[model samples]
Target: MYSRISTVALLARALSDQAESYDYLLAGAGTAGLVIACRLSENPKVSVLVIESGPDVRNDGVVTSGNFSFTGANDRVLSYRAGKAVGGRSIVNGMVYIRGEQAQFDAFEKLGDSEWNWDSLFSYGKKGERFEGPDTAQKTAGVTANPADHGTNGSLTTWKSIGVNPVTDINGGNPHGFVSAPQTLDRDKIRRSSSAAAYYKPVDSRPNLKVIQGNMKRIIWANEKKNRAVASGFYAKEEKLGVKVKSAMPGVGENMQDHNAMVIGYGTANTLVGDTPFATLVTAQDALGNKMPVLAASSRSQISTWAQAASTYTGGAIDAKTYEKRFQIQHDLIFKQNVTIAELFPTNLGSAIVSQLWTTHPFSWSSVHLKSLVSFDDPVIDPNIFSLQFDIDMLVAVARKEQKAYSTPPLSTFVAPNQVLPTNATDEQWTAYVQANAGNTLHVVDTCAMLPLDLGGIVDSKLKVYGTSNMRVVDASVIPVELTGHTTGPLYAVAEKAADIINNDS
Candidate 1:
């Protein structure tokens, strides 16, 4: 008891005397957080401190085993499906390395931030990667990669997957056709390489970097008037604390988006006897490894898409001109360039793998709102799934497309006659099926979007939150637009660019 008391007292005194401030103080030491923290502290003259929401959880099963042997997302590792660790989503997420469609980033530039486009971000994508091509034996097993499209050396490592054969180079500004994608994996270590493993650990010994665990209550703002709102520091309630500040922007938690699946199951003739059934599943080993999914992959190949002026089909009341300008880019990308818009995945069903078709760009939107700012409490997340008619119409088109492709000659032979969701069903039936079966890809993004302040945006081009100078949100939440496949690749690019922007600013 005496020893414990002494330790507590020492810790209190240490914190009270701790330098009182840092050059940079980040709230969450997650995926993007860690990346920025590492980059800023690189300057020996600067000091950085990170306050992580969860404990370090360095070697915990949730962080290490999720890649190799850990099977369930809601199983033993961590009960909740979200990343509740120091490394954030990178630790818990399946590390598939696929970037966003070129058009999506270009659309970001269209939304008034000319600095944020595919060309600039493409370089950062390569900057954060250390890709290793497949070996001769591995190539024979179906793994493939274009050496030019990948970075030879960087913080994160990616390599070929034996899941599918290649049709084209996916990372080279366009990802429309068939391609064997890469994963953020440490081939030498034979484990899933998370952001923590890739970007944080090597620089852990840096004297300028300090990491802590605590909840960020709010950004402490200066009461005095200024041109832009300036935050003096951040506040956290470790014990008894209280503070209230009303949010200035209504766009803070709105505009969240996620991918939805339109599945058509079947009972296929189990050929190869006991051969493991494979399909394009999102992340499963089975979200990439061995399970059913939210995101998908292939032994299967997915697609490209186009959108028309269909504002009447929208779910929420958004700006009409804003909606048209955005959809115009989607249409242009389809006719002018090669960009993946939807995906086709195969899922395991005890004895067979079902084909699932979903739109990469869904019109539906949702929010994750905070009810209180004074306490450390979980926010309410409202996922308005398939609330938009445009998404369902696209899924219907996708189902019809799936039916047409499979019912043809060579691909038709593999598709069994035991209709689970009946591909021959009418448009009405398809709509009903879409409404009843629509599910998440777990590819949620843009809650704290990176758009100009004039367009209902939460953050500016530099990734600094609007209305506040020092408070910035760097995470999957800051992605202005959602990508087509696994969201990890584009997220890294965002962090890398943010680091450069921060470095340039300071």
Candidate 2:
């Protein structure tokens, strides 16, 4: 009877009294969380409550200007302390907004649900986008953009807001080639376009939506009704309270995936000019003067190159045959259509031109789970980054390509050969370097993956939690596999679609 629940999100502090009941009580005001909240509350009759553990630092100068460290959760490959700010990672991220290959999304349908194909998600992707096409100065530096391929209207936007095979406009669904990344900045290239800025700011005035700055400590559980797996709720409480385990869904926090990345440097013939990382800086006199030309990212990428002969790692319910069907899409994208598999970009750090690269189609597997019975304790986020031999091989091939890039006419003119970098390095040296240095790109997904129940899936095509009557996960965690682009763009698409699903059900 509770299956038709809907939720909408905004980070407005609980202005007055907390309501005794709400149509939806969302545990997070995160990336997709707020998007779902906002969409669900579109119906004025539906009351939505968004709970945020972090403070609302929406316009805090310190938060906007730079980054701060938060202590919690360490990956097995390395330690990265990510904070839970009001806007989630969008506020403190690199602000690179990009879409993965079309085939990648289309493969989602094959993996489990027909409704999750790229064609449908492609629209949702553009739904929240407010794309700012490359300006004349940007175009002068080899930047290209398709105006039609971008959305002119949306809350999450440039200011607002791959691959081994080479294709133009990764947002067009086929990620390949060397191209400039799409930014999540505004028209002036100042201030990051977070979900708070794009989706919530305008709608914060809505009477039906409310946000509280605090953690959701527990959900008072109810007895099983209609003989359901886990009926009504799940909870967290003091040990003395002694909560009993209701049910166990083995796929709660398994099947984790993240892009393993490492930065390789090249000694430059000329001393680096700008403080920001990149090949060249395009500038105009903004309010802060021309000291810095607003930071932007440029990358050269290609397919994994080993696509034709790549192997898959199969376990759990996804047997060899099922895994083969899943991997065959990636193989065809690289070998058949020649889509870009890895992303390589240059950043001018210190005296060297550092090239940051990561493989997009990682088959390696890992898991993240709570360390103890406590709910709020940081989960053990152990991503076996180099779990696949294929990942290392891909990084080596990308390094080889970078060597060629450094040897090219213009770059060769000013860049010196690396004394201890991937430039001109041997395959053996590259492999060792990758194994020692590779870390996450922060493009993580699939922990609470959406797939078939027997296939280690925690959520369904509608994103409803497997055993729960009303609870659903509408974030990157529900994604079943890695894709060619950053998780941000696709996550927004996922939320957009999720909102519609919830609203329709309501």
| TM per prediction | 0.78, 0.80
Candidate of highest lDDT: 2
- lDDT on C-alpha atoms for all candidate structures: 0.61, 0.62
- List model 1 lDDT by residue over 359-467, tens digit each: 6766566677766653346676666666545567656665665565455544455556546456567778767766766676677787777877655577888777765
Candidate 2, residues 33-150, lDDT tens digits: the string is 7787778787898887777778777888765653322111123346544548667877777666777777667767877776998889888988889888767866665566777677
Evaluate residue 403 in candidate 2 and report its C-alpha lDDT on the 0 to 100 scale: 60
Regions of candidate 1 where Cα sits further than 4 Å from its true position: 1-19, 66-80, 154-166, 223-225, 238-247, 262-320, 330-338, 347-351, 354-356, 373-377, 400-419
Cα lDDT of model 1 overall?
0.61
